[model samples]
Target chain A: MKAEKILEALGEIDEKFIEEAMNYNMKKKFNWKPIIAVAACAAFALAAIPVANHFANNDMVDGGTTAGTVAPVPGDEVDDDVDYVAYEYSVNKGEIIGNHVVELKVSKSRGRYVIKDKLDTQKTVYLNGMEWTAKYENSWSETDYKVIVDRYTGVCNGRNMSFGVNSITGKCEFFMFKTTGDIDKTVKLTRDELYEIAYDNFLSGGYTEDPENYQLSDECSNGSAGYWFKFTRFVDGIETSEHVRIGLRNNGDLYWFVGNRIGEMKDVDVSGFDMDKIYDAIEIKVKKIYGDAYVDFEREGAVLRKRTDGSYVFDYSGHIDVKNSYGKVVQERCFLIVIMD
Target chain B: MTDETILEMLFARSEESISAIDEKYGHKCRKMALGILGNEQDAEECVNDAYLGLWNAIPPERPSSLAAFLYGVLRKLSLKKYRANTAGKRCSYYSDALDEIESTFASAETVESALEGKYLVEAMREFILTLNEENRAVFLRRYWFMESCREIAAALGTSEKNVTVRLTRTREKLRKFLEERGVEI
Candidate 1:
């Protein structure tokens, strides 16, 4: 039989049973806190300077120490065209080109945002109380400078945690703690224990979800919001989509927490039908934005989200390879299907 | 009101059970209906029909999940309206949902079992259980909930593209699974 026949056969299954078994249920959410924060950091670093130069902030960190700020290297004023250079930490492994910033010497990235991908090791790396403006000189978008301490590596061993705000969306994504040891010090906390630690430490007062109707869904979120657990609460026997993610390390260390972040959107209004047009709009928008930077893409899936104004926003995702000016794949990622606002 | 509270009202045969279900899941059921029928009149009609369906079902079937029970009622009614009035011309997210997964069995040859709905459903259910947690979520979100990639992306906190890609692959896998099982599509 053909796929159409299979779907027709599928139609015979009572959608009601499917609804009860699946639709009315809630899937656990992944944490995008780290990636968004780090990507926002990369966005800031890219827009801030071209070659070796300071961010011009001389910003003092939480512990009263200055962040990495090197003196302007020779020929810094001459090369005003380069978009970005290497990172300071990536110089020794031949990761330097004209000696500017550090390039990530990624050994093997299993998964950050893609499906069915996992990092080889549970690693935890933190951006020590950094603030970035997620904007570029090529655009008019300039978010406010927000203090964000993003950790995207394995588990942590410290206890000092702080909060940061992501100006791009005007939401806080981090509740970080200081690292006192290595990954060995991290302890994997159970679901109940994680909740206990979170409630006793973080959500006792400010949590909006009524504790009465909630249950723990999963122990971990997505790759970006690393090493966190989820809680699902119900109202009137219906589980609301809202969920809370508390960031923890494998060693049961707590540094960050996020709440009421609904990852899946449902009950969308698909009132009209124009499948081909919708696909066309998405492809056009993608080409317009990425142009040559986007190498190629495999059409992933589509979803509908309800906007605040009560309309629907349709999106389609793809796994694409994006190359930089040097013909190097700067990003091999599952590019979120550009949203239709 | 909690579903338990509503269930209690339903069990007591309180007339307010109807209003309570409406008050809680009314808008949701309406949206579900609208997404299927794409007709306001039909969507509204489904809401009433769902209320009646619930009134009848609850005295005998105290569903553990009230939202599912209500959505099931509304969705079945809306689809009935869609197939009957629309000449089987589906034009809502439900059809798009079918489109998302249609690629899997596109290449398969039909078999005698394709006509057996119960057999195919059971095969589908068994296949669904074999999926990994992430894939299963995407499958249910698209096929069962008829949600868009954007919503699944939001729920998963990934890009909509990833959700789409995952679902697309899942359907392909499902097709292969069914084929391997001697179930032709």
Candidate 2:
């Protein structure tokens, strides 16, 4: 048989299949409108919703001896239930071009966390907290701001380990919730149990009115820190930057919970936004730093969320491996974050 | 610019559509062509021709996926160019891919004389549709794009050895699939 004939036949496969193969990276960007619609319908009839959790909720906290490092893994059971609407699109090929200012405002940072601390020792940590400052940068601007945890007069029970706020924008940078309970080294919870705890904590903490609306971050795992679960907030089909991360002790006790709940973002057009620029910016930034060394910027996740004040927050989280001239991975699997642009 | 915007430009017969397509998919287009032709000049020419082909096709034919449609055009152009080349100047990468397909159908010569290209395509399509998402992607990436195992592996965040093993298994599966269907080649 002629190889060319078979080659030609291979080319004649359906365009849909061809499209599917081409979009292996954006494989999650399926016809997610249907799944999201189903979730929305489920949200409306909350009272009549079944008490049974979609995932297996057995209290099986007795597995896996070694604590694992939490890394983002795609496609969890929750992925089947609450799908993420990633801003997936191609870019116009080129350099850092136009300037688009995405402002994170203070007024939009109004999310309440019912800080419930069981132990009295937790109060001392909150009072004697040392000041920490970090710089935040997007493509347009960079500013150094102090991390300020708002002292909610009535709820400051010392159980809330840290409620981080950006001094400049006054937006809730992050709010941490620690269990302050006893930690048993032998207690290891399964991913599903941890997820259930995370979901319960997210709602009980008053992060959002609807907990089912959020998509579970692909990267939920049990590690040395304990069983960790992250659920990302979604609005109008866009996976917002607002998310809740919960870490549980091996014994399935809540260790510490950190969450970001951004207010509603207006006019977030995922289809209209050019995703190529974000990817291109990451590539250019890598090249600038590495100076043409063999570098692979494997995108673990890219998110576009809303700042409570309704500004867009575009962030890229990925693993970058920079190889030296000899093709050895000198910088192996280091995490990179391009904070809100 | 979105593919829809580019298509609209093409419908209006604007030359800028060509530039937009070039700017958006030009690098990937060139890379695919180069994979098949193994020559930078030929790949560049093939990509430029593909753009013109896209321009001519879009007015009468509205494709659901512009990127896939463009790749199909570019691939056909690249394959035609590859066939026109001399034996010594052939792209080993593409030849290797084709050789695997040849071997897959080598034993099922019973219907080779009776088969039309479309039947083979239909049979292959049926086989491809049966594969799981990952395997189907690996098969298409290897054969359709004429990508190296290393390239495919890198794109997939896996090892080249794993890709090679997957291709080998997929080829075996394809051979059995076509053999079972009595569609030789």
Candidate 3:
């Protein structure tokens, strides 16, 4: 059982054994050429047909347009009560990139919306009256131009709300969507009261809270049945924002609506407010005034927190409050806002 | 070369088939058989039996991996020879090895029955693959080829006791792996 014996055995394969094995194999008979030929033909056909068709239909087609196109204009008249409007615009031939340019036409009649991005020279957009000033910036990589929309506030079912378009991504990011239908009549809850409700909810396991410890802010929202909350917490001296929205069904089933945004406020009137500029301006003002104090703000359902080191974090929830620059509560229910410094 | 090509050459009763198999896998198959059977004559006989089995099988069956198929045949032949030659010999090497593996395959009733069929071979292959390369090589050399603990130790550049410990742990792991994969062993 020594290593040398094993090595010797491994090295000493008998030639006679192989000869016998060969003889044994020679006596057996099987015909497999037909099966192999069929399989090979099938494999070849599968790999070729679709590829040839794709190459054959590579030609581009001209897309047709309908009627007059609306040009981009500042201070366009908008109805205050209206949810959305449609406008047509065209991207000139000089602005087209690569071998093709797709113009996405978006039209909204009432709250219903439709977006069509076809291979064409012209594009139309149906935007909400509140989001009329949303600007679009094209990028070399992505087909859609980055849209920057100003921020705005509204009340729904007693909750204050805000939303805006991302300056870089043209994506609509919500700030707050609190039910503000009866904001004037309902008694407003203070920050401390809101914190107690959240804490109690967590302790009783009645609310599903985030595992990460985030500092509570005024940014919150109220949805169809329940609410949403967002907080920013400092871990290892680094600030991180965590947002969660919980919906409580009548049968006591809890559903989570968590994302990076608080509400769909980016597609609304809040498009005029340049949140990035506002955040930068506030950070400067807070550092100058507060002098190293931990500064945070919440509006609609968006929360922004800044540590003494100047590192900031942004998060939103659909069931939170939106606050203004002066720390005054704007939305009564849940909505988020960007806080300073 | 493919199993089909080897089988076709084998079925044609070609001398080149023997030469081709030896050229492709003689060393590996012989080494594996030697590791389990221990005796050179027994291992050689197992390899010969494997070739005979392959010759008989190829008329109906075409293996995907000829080397694996040959190795399996040799292993079964060697194990069967070991059982027949050592029957009722309580103090023999075969008895000792069987005793060592008894606890793992206690429910199998017979060692040959336990080791037979595709399930056992597949389980062993999977278990061996999961082991660290060095440990797997040592285990294969010791158990499958019937090499001694000292041989495994020297080959792996470790102490005999370390080889024993590794073998024990690997056997336990193989046992667990097989059991988890729904094998009685």
Candidate 4:
């Protein structure tokens, strides 16, 4: 029909349908957690630098330890006029280079000297601790430093590293951890698990390697935050590999982003099942456990749905399964209800 | 107006509610129903049915826009009635019009495809918001209220052919708008 006619028909519609639809909307209230999480993330960024300093002061360094200094060079000192080159870290490994300062956080506890960056801030690095100071040079590439340990004591690992941030390569490097064992073992997390890990990392401090490069705000106290996670997995016994990246913005909202493709869960409800085993988990439960109602399961995209008597159903979209409590798939059919409503 | 006010008046079976709706939108609703059904009796019946539906629905339902809510209900009822009455008829005007527009999507094998649930409604809302006030009113009058080209022209003080052209252009715009938002047609 003509658009105008269709609009007219829509305009002339009876009031009952509108009421019913509105009632449905009221019944299914929109989740506000994601919005609150985003707001909290913004607040955290504003107050992050000061809080880091506050914690650093309480956990202060001993006297005689070398403190690195960084300052912007005078414009008249150099004949060449270059806009301030914000230092950043490379995209490789677990480091994130940014325009201001490089930041990285390691999950596991490694040796002492191995944790410190090449900058001569301090020899000892503490967990959840940040050290910020000024550098002498105008450019990062021009400076050089070595990773040193007290030779007489011989208490820490001896791993020397140095780099410079110049106009040609204006990048600041932040190293998190060094893996000595199998890298495969370190990366074997399901998409949901990886998202949770990443989200936690972002919440604690921040990740340097994030493409979004979200930083903590100065005004943020402590609330919920969001982040993304990417992990590499070996699928087949043969030579085949795949990268699984999941976008996790809210505490419970998990979005699938495979390769270059990104979309919300189609028909799945990610509320049920363990978030850790979300990769290949199937949950089956009776919708009306003691009743005569039969449950049916349907798959849409990577999600599963459970319905009872073709009316009420539960969605298990982006969740991972750890236990198959519903019995074997080859035997009798099983159904799981993720959400009660 | 607040839904509480509407509901309070509706549940009380207040003549004021009916009078208020009639005084404000009765002619407009009648014109739209007549445009779609092409019969005065059916159009009047649709409007009365709309009132009764509104009376019954207000207690549990709170609508953001009373006019839009009423229009939506009336349209559904009108369409259902039209379908039932013309079940075995040979190409009724209302059926023909719907079929002509619906055929394009049917041929593309997307006529049966649901509009991704709420996305379709959202898209339609967005599309309506983009039109100019006059055009938006005209569009709503014709499609939502089911007013004829002649009736719309009379209401807007324009020619019937101009109304037709404007409607055609609007349809094309809507089609493109829906397609951009990933709707099949």
Candidate 5:
């Protein structure tokens, strides 16, 4: 077996990151963000929320081993969970580019996940005072679960009612006591009762939901578990991309409140988007990226994507359904197109 | 030459594409390799091998940055060459650099599963974003750009010891940071 190359691994942490760092070195433009920041000050110019929040000396202990001199001890075993003691710190403000400083905030339950499997689940819950039935697409993976546990803090309110979101990976889930902690029986509750518990217990943990624009979408369950009720939010009068859901156990305790789905970003007027020209460019660009000229794709309406520097640019996203000559759909993949000015 | 022009030549399979790359990125790639392998001959071999790899990869991969793509290939080739050259006694500038960081994670009881490729990259990305300009540049030059502490110190008009001391402190802090974030040391 080949030895793990630490140097190579560190060098490639961000192929893009290294490029940006190189550019910074070449340009000699000094960044002042780290003076007020904590550790992780040895990176590229892009300022991200610190994964570890608190301020500490971070100096190595005098004992143990020194760098590069200590050899791996054979027959030694260690547990990852026990050793992981990271307290992630999030930064809202970013670099000041031009006159605008953009602070990018996102949902906690957002991270890259290898889709293990999507579990179809459904249930009903009262929104404000009205009962709504909703469906859910839930997935469970050990790696994904570890990722969430490692990053977010959650509260276990008896009978599987808990609220948590690991911001880095963007995993947000909140469980409520839907039915008196029992799956066999349904306990009835009034509007006032549901509203009090939902707002006070679960909603305080960084979840912003609009009671007026709450819309019920679908409901289903894994049969063995309580049903999940999904709801979409429309903040103010404008519709956003965030999704909020509440799950119910058969014995009538609103056992779950999950707010997820990609957030609807900066409201920009993309009405000037030239449908014909953009699609033509996408057709060519997708071919170049994927190496398949016959990729049949569609472009959703364009929106402004916010960069770290608080600047917004026109961007569009769509997916391509690559079908064989037989017209049978063989594969599906999503792609993003950024329209740079 | 601009990356777009070089890319177009490569896409056209023009023989001049290789020369363009040579003219544009050859010295940069060679210096990068020299940092890792610590020898001119091996660094040159790594550079040539990297060019060949780029010739084969660019047709299907339209990288956002051609220099990054080429550097990625060259760095990998250099690491391979360094490994082959250091069988009896593992010694090189690259090894020295790795040794500096190994104090953070190289342990008999280290959890290998906790240190995954994707996670490290993302962690490093987040970590880098937290740095200020001067410290960040010194740290990146030594680690990412594969420059020596002396070189970085010279470039920044500081003592070699200062660069090494700053990096050591910063890395130790990173150790604490990752550990606090549940990264297995």
Candidate 6:
């Protein structure tokens, strides 16, 4: 078979697949919360500088107090309505960029944005009668400062769970919470309990995938770090490439969470096609392709995703690698799909 | 604008339909042609010709997906242009893609009955419909769209090496698929 024949045949494929490839479907809505959190960190740091200066001046004159317990007094300038411009700073470029200015809501009473010039120092402040802390980590190699404590909603054993956000995309990249005590290697929460916690957190974080579409699997529960849970998206009992992974500490605390929403998968009816014949045909085709070449079949699955035009395409059924007699990969990620209809 | 609305305008012979299509899918169509021809001037001319082709076909034919229809037409036109441009000398990018597929089955010396184009197309379509979403996207983007590996990589948010590797394996798979179905090389 000539390759041009194959190319011409490909040109005649169903329009649904052509339209599926037309748009990559990797649309990511720039999340604003993490950017707001980054801005709030900067604003709080700016708002705290004056208070710290005031405390320093008073301590120099009368030695009343120094850098400690410097609370904003009632009827002070803190009650005035003020606007703090939180510019989106590009850490990679080492400069403040973008026209998006998030207005920081500085609390008039006790929600003082407190940040210290020192590195690796955490400042605790009372906001809405809840203890909120701002922790800063300054990389000595780079001049960019990462303020990592704006969305701190949970605390385990007096430690706040911190999540790193991509400064440009504003998506929550990863969550990290290390255990301190001897409870590092213990399973404190059952799989069901972990699912409940992860599901609630997943929903609260504004992720919009249905829980029913995902098949939950406890990947690792006996590791030294914590339990690793993955929620893989599947359609017609065939797994897709999208998943959400959550890692929990032995004390039932969330230590790691990373989710991918690039390719949106949807459930479709495949009852029309005989899947057994399809798999069998695919297997035969694979063997013929490799011949005597060493083949490594990694995954046999299907992908069904909704196109931009609201049509569903269920394809990319399987993947394998073909190596030559010398054990070198001749073809990598061989994609094969068979549709009888 | 929605495809239906633009299509209605096209059906009603409104000249605004051209601008609407140019607004909605002009950049993509041009990018597709550029990926195939690898020249800005040739790609621009090819897209214009493709638009003319679309205008001529819509009155006699109503496609369910206008984007797909335009894509198919543009792909044909771009390949035609590529063949004309690379007739004497070797052009690398799109020709490289073609050669990758050619190498899959070009080595065969056996003489047998050639498979009909219709069956080959049918088998190819059936084979394509079975691919997973990402691989299908990559395959169509490279082969059908005539996009370079670099363009495919950028569009799919993957590396060029990954796209090239997938294309190689996919071409091999296509060869095996056709051969098992009694297609002679």
Q: Higher DockQ: candidate 2 or 3?
A: 2
Q: Which pairs clash (backbone N, Cα, C closer than 3 Å) in model 6? A: A1-B185, A44-A113, A315-B131, A315-B132, A316-B131, A316-B132, A317-B131, A317-B132, A337-B130
Off by over 4 Å in 3: A1-341, B1-8, B22-42, B90-96, B103-134, B153-161, B174-185
TM-score of predicted structure 6: 0.42
Ranking by TM-score: 2, 6, 1, 5, 4, 3
Which of 3 and 4 is ahead in lDDT?
Answer: 3
lDDT against true structure, model 5: 0.48
Question: Per-candidate RMSD vs. true structure?
Answer: 21.8, 21.5, 30.2, 26.8, 24.8, 25.4
Candidate 3 residue lDDT tens string, B122-175: 555555557765576666556555556774554343578987887788768866
Question: What DockQ does every candidate get?
Answer: 0.10, 0.23, 0.02, 0.05, 0.11, 0.20
What do the candidate models score in CA lDDT, each in turn? 0.48, 0.54, 0.41, 0.39, 0.48, 0.53
Top TM-score: which candidate number?
A: 2
lDDT of 4 by residue, B18-118 (tens): 76576445755665566566678887899999988987888577676676777677777777666556655623335544543453342334422534334
**What is candidate 6's lDDT per residue for A1-341, written digit by digit as tens?**
35555676678888988877865432122132445544554554455466546544553212110122232322133312221111121222111111111111232332312222222234443322333454432100010111111222223224333322222233221122322232122234545666777766655543334556777674433232234567777878898776766656423446443333324435456676565665566667667644544365543466544433355443443445554322345333433433333
List TM-scores of chain B, every candidate. Answer: 0.88, 0.93, 0.61, 0.72, 0.86, 0.87
Model 4: how far residue A221 lies from native, Å: 51
Query: Cα deviation of B8 in candidate 6 (Å)?
Result: 1.4
Which regions of candidate 1 deviate over 4 angstroms? A1-341, B107-115
Per-residue C-alpha lDDT of model 1 across residues A1-341, encoded as one tens digit per residue: 24444544544444445543332212224233665655654543354354224323444322222333332231233222221111222112122111111122221121111111122222223232122211100000001111112222222222222222221222222222222222123333534565577656444633343555566654444332225556666778888877655555422346443333343334365556565777677667656545656566555566655534444456443455555433456333332323454
| Tens-digit lDDT track of model 2 for A152-255 | 11122212223322222323332122121221122334445556777777767554556777777756553333446777877889987767666664233464
What is the clash count for each candidate, in the order shown?
55, 11, 71, 66, 47, 9
> Candidate 2, which segments miss by more than 4 Å at Cα?
A25-139, A142-341, B107-111
For model 5, the DockQ equals 0.11
Query: lDDT: which candidate is best?
Result: 2
Order by DockQ, highest first? 2, 6, 5, 1, 4, 3
- How well does each candidate superpose onto the true structure, as a TM-score? 0.41, 0.44, 0.28, 0.32, 0.39, 0.42
Q: Give the Å error, residue A5, model 2.
A: 1.2
lDDT of 6 by residue, B49-155 (tens): 98899998988789999989998899889888887887656564567667777677764333113654687688888888767787888888877777788767755
lDDT of 4 at A311: 23
- Model 6, residue A230: displacement in angstroms? 43
